[model samples]
Target: MGHADLVARLVEAGGLPGEWRSVFERVPRDAFVPDLVWDDDRRPVHRAREPGRWSGLVHRDAPVVTQLDDGAPDGVGYVSSSASMPSIVALMLDELDVAEGMRVLEIGTGTGWNAALLAARLGDGNVTTVEVDPVLAGLARARLARAGFRPAVVAADGMAGWPGHAPYDRVIATAAVRRVPYAWVAQTRPGGRIVTPFGTAFHNGTLLRLDVRDDGTASGRFGGDVGFMWTRSERTPHGSVEERVLPGHDHTESTTDLHPYEPVSDFDAGFAIGLRVPGMLATVVHDGAPADGRFTVYLMDPGSDSWASWRITPRPRGRYRVRQHGPRALFDELAAAYDWWRRIGRPAHDRFGLTVTPDGRQHLWTDTPDRVLDLVPDPGKERAG
Candidate 1:
């Protein structure tokens, strides 16, 4: 599709704004993408001046992986940086409500595409982006400058929120953070908006948009689902699933008499489960043949080294079995959350909201009105070694 068609699709996807469609059409996505990057299939693809192919690739809904293996672009390890998919970036910008002349602070400046767009919307002087990786930051700075857009590009830990330019009108983080940094809340002006993908031990990311209140308490609804690169400081390998014990199972198998398996990506279902069963981590693993597929979901806890596995059989229907085991019975918790979701008529994303206090306390709430659930630890405590 051409630029016009692409922009139209983005609008339909609720990604591009009516006012910003022109900017999307004008800014060359191909310019910001590095020469060497990975495509959707995780295959390395080089960008060349083939107007037909390059334009199509840039317009696709998939994210172009810009940095791999912690900023190593040579495809040596995991994805660390990316020009976030068009829809995801648009969704975040929409939540941010960035307007002309607003001072914006963006964390995780990866390929400079986002920074360029911010510069395009709110003049270069009004935007400041912080990138933790020196190499990535330098490349983004040069790329933005070459594209005729230059924001205050700083190479510093984004967790700190660049105190030199305090009190920003809007603060958005491109990276996923385990805890909402106190610095971000402090730097945002009262009534200003702060948007970020708050990570949990859950299966998906939650898009949090909080309004900074006069007393430093921020509250708002969870806007949508997003997946982002984890902050550098929080990056670590979650030990192999095999090492963790599976609840109620003596060994791995193909079938059992538990909850039937269903293959559907329901964000609300996962979020509700996460909230109901706090501190539980679940990972989805797809296996078996294409025609006869099977899925194994493992739920575990890092603090207790406990876990459970649910196996779904392909009886050409949604049939599955859930087994509980381990010191912390994860399967039982998951089953309880699943039943709760059903009892509540499967609450959607709109019903959920996030409230963050000045002291760095975060709460996830449903519209039905219950006390906010605290997801982070107290700031005063530290690991006792």
Candidate 2:
């Protein structure tokens, strides 16, 4: 598709406002992307080697990985940063609801593509973006300058936010976080908005938009099914399903008629389960080709070194094997959480809401703050914002 065609598709599908049409057209995504980038499948696509493939990936609405394992040469290959998917980026900007000359602060300036878009619309002088990785920050700054956009790109931890430019009209985070930093709410004006991807160890995440109140608290509902990487400071343990979950290890064996269909694959169930069971992560391993439809779902909590596996066979006789080991019964926790979700009428993710207290405590609620979920705050991270 042509640039215009892709922009049109993004605007239409992402529910982007008509005012952003020119901004999307003006900011070219390729300018901020690195020469050596990776696709979602982990295939390395060097722009110099395969210009056509690189251009195709850059032009489309898909996310292009710009860095891996925090740029470590021999790292375990964890995804650290990337340009966000265009459609989701548009949706976030729509939620930001910026106006002419509105000052905005952006957390996690990965490729600077999003910053450039905001700069194009609001002007460089009115935008300031903070990046946790100094290398990424410097690269993004250079890219922004070369592209005729010079938004302030600060090389500092975004969780603390850039308070030097206080009272921003809006704030947006490119990375996902377990908690919305109180610094964001404190830095934003009373009537301003803060948008970020909020998630738990059990799920990749959902987009949360909070309105900062004059009383120094922010409250809002969750929206969209987004899976941005967690901010560096708050990332869950990296992909360690094999290391933690050993099927041969000594474990209590049981049988369950409950399948992985609703609790594992269903987004609504997974999100609610995340709220109930903290510090839990889920991964699916296939017996053979996924087409065979034989697989095992592993639930793990790195904090407690506990793990559970639910096996699925192509032809089931109404029963499946389940094995769990370690101090905490992860399978039981997950099953109980799923049951609670069903008992409460299986609410969609959008029905959930979040409120950040003045002292930086995050509280999850259903429908209204009056109905708060009894979630224990990790003392170590109570002021992490």
Candidate 3:
């Protein structure tokens, strides 16, 4: 499968607007993709060595990691940058809802494919993209030029935004952010739109589309399942389950009838819990390599050096083992968050919305702006270490 095949698949899936179909078809995703790509295992796959595999991945409807740990030589660590999945790219573009002659500002120009799509839809002169990493920005600029489209590829911090070309008609971020930068809102004109992937440490994230109001504030709701890598400045603290939840650590033992199935795995529950219990990360480790159903769900907060382990066995019969360490009882906090969610009619993610003021404060609400989610952290439950 190649570019045409990918476009056909996207069209078949149905959000490829008539206009965008031509844009997607015209701009070659392969040209924007680098010769060096990383596999799911974080191992580098050079186009020269694995041409077929590289082509397949490039054309596949999945995200392709383009850089790891900011291109550090300390060996492949985490996915620092990637060519976002084509479907998500199309979805975000569709949500962007750009029109001809509309000035657009794009954040996080990873592979330049998204920016190319934007430039193709709106003229090159109307599109401006920002990338924090100078190297990635330069490469993306060259790729965009090679593909016959040259939008202003500014090598600057995307979070700050390319303010020189302010008052954009639309602003979209390819990176996820915990806080929607006021610069983006301030740079966008009244009635403009800002679409971004917004998430907290507890969750990978969902799509956020904010409408910039005349009052210099933007407010919008969560609607899509688009999870992008966090901007460098707002990245969640990183720590492995094994690294944080060690056996030697002091802990308080307890039991909970609450299973990990709903709280940790369910989309709605996890999203709600993320909003309630901020800065928490969960990881699951199975008991046996033979593929046993029994596993342990570990919740960690690297910021506070706190962790909680919830073990589940086949036929649990509602009794699960839970052990928590550090001053903050992560298990208790998560359980409380889950209880709160259940208490309030069990809302879906779409019901959640956020408002960003000019001062850069974010307010999360349920259903409407007035029905705010009480997100203030409890001092006992969320103390800094």
Root-mean-square deviation (CA) per prediction? 4.2, 2.4, 2.4
TM-score of each: 0.84, 0.94, 0.95
C-alpha displacement of 61 in model 1, angstroms? 2.6
Off by over 4 Å in 1: 1-5, 11-14, 48-55, 72-76, 242-265, 285-287, 290-293, 314-326, 368-385
Question: Predictions ranked by lDDT, top down?
Answer: 2, 3, 1
Candidate ordering by TM-score (highest first): 3, 2, 1
Tell me which residue pairs clash in candidate 3. Answer: none
Query: How much does candidate 1 score in TM-score?
Result: 0.84
**Residue-by-residue lDDT tens digits, candidate 1, 1-385:** 7556767788887778787787787777777888877666676666664555556667788787877787554544688888888888888888899777789999999989888988999999999999999989999999999999989999999999999988899999998765678799899999899999865555447787888889987777775668777777655345567766634446333334454242125677776676666557677677856455677777767665566678766674544666555467777766777787778678786687777676676766777326554434211112100
What digit string (tens of lDDT, one per residue) describes model 2 on residues 1-385? Answer: 4567778877777556788888888887888899999887888899999998888888888888889999997787788999999888988999999999899999999999999999999999999999999999999999999999999999999999899988899999999888787899999999999999988888878999999999999999998899999888887666478788776678999999988989998999999988888777889999889998799999877777788989998676548899999888989999999999999889999999989989888888889888888874222122222
Error of 2 at 351 (Å): 0.2
**Candidate of highest lDDT:** 2
lDDT of 3 at 47: 98
- Model 1: lDDT to the true structure: 0.74
**Residue 376 lDDT, candidate 1, scale 0-100:** 40
- Cα lDDT tens digits for candidate 3, 1-385: 7899999998998968887899899997899889999888777899999999899889989999999889887853878889999999989988888888899999999999999999888899999999999999999999998888999999898888888998799999999877788999999999999999987777768999999999988998998777889888777656677677787899988888988888888888888888888778888888787267789988888778988899888774778899989978999999999999999988998998988888777888999988876674211222323
